[model samples]
Target: MNITDLMWKNATAYGYTFTRTPPDAACAARVTLLEWLDAGRINPAVARVFPLEQAAEAQRHLIEDRPFGRVLLTLAR
Candidate 1:
């Protein structure tokens, strides 16, 4: 098995065109995202939330090819 062997494995890239979209449309999408999070539609994929300094730890894990999903790094509160 090789990297190129998985070409298009993730399918098409998707994203929001906030900069190009009208302000109202962009705002609506943002609101929708917030609502989804509030309603538990969006949840953390990782077991732990890493503090900012843990960024280096996260990088090492990623570089070492450790299992991961959404790695959330938090700011000081």
Candidate 2:
């Protein structure tokens, strides 16, 4: 079966090529990620968040590339 025949409802799940963001492009692309994810337009590789108090632990995991994706820092109030 041809993917294009699905009429794009499976667009986010298949039939596209994604590139690794270069350092120069990463900063500009960050906001776009949130926009797309929130709109359910793309299925990200991973999504994780940590509260402000656990920021240090989150940084450690990120530096080790353990949780290798966007880590949202959440606030508690």
Reference-based TM-score, model 2: 0.43
Error of 2 at 42 (Å): 1.7
14 Cα displacement, candidate 2 (Å): 15
Query: For residues 10-73, what per-residue lDDT tens digits would candidate 1 score against the true structure?
Result: 5454456789989999899989989998999987467456789899987776667565566668
Error of 2 at 20 (Å): 16
State which candidate has the highest lDDT. Answer: 1
How many clashes in each candidate? Answer: 0, 0
TM-score per candidate, chains pooled: 0.55, 0.43
Best by TM-score: 1
Q: Give the whole-model CA lDDT for all candidates, comma-separated.
A: 0.74, 0.72
Residue 59 of model 1 has an lDDT of 74
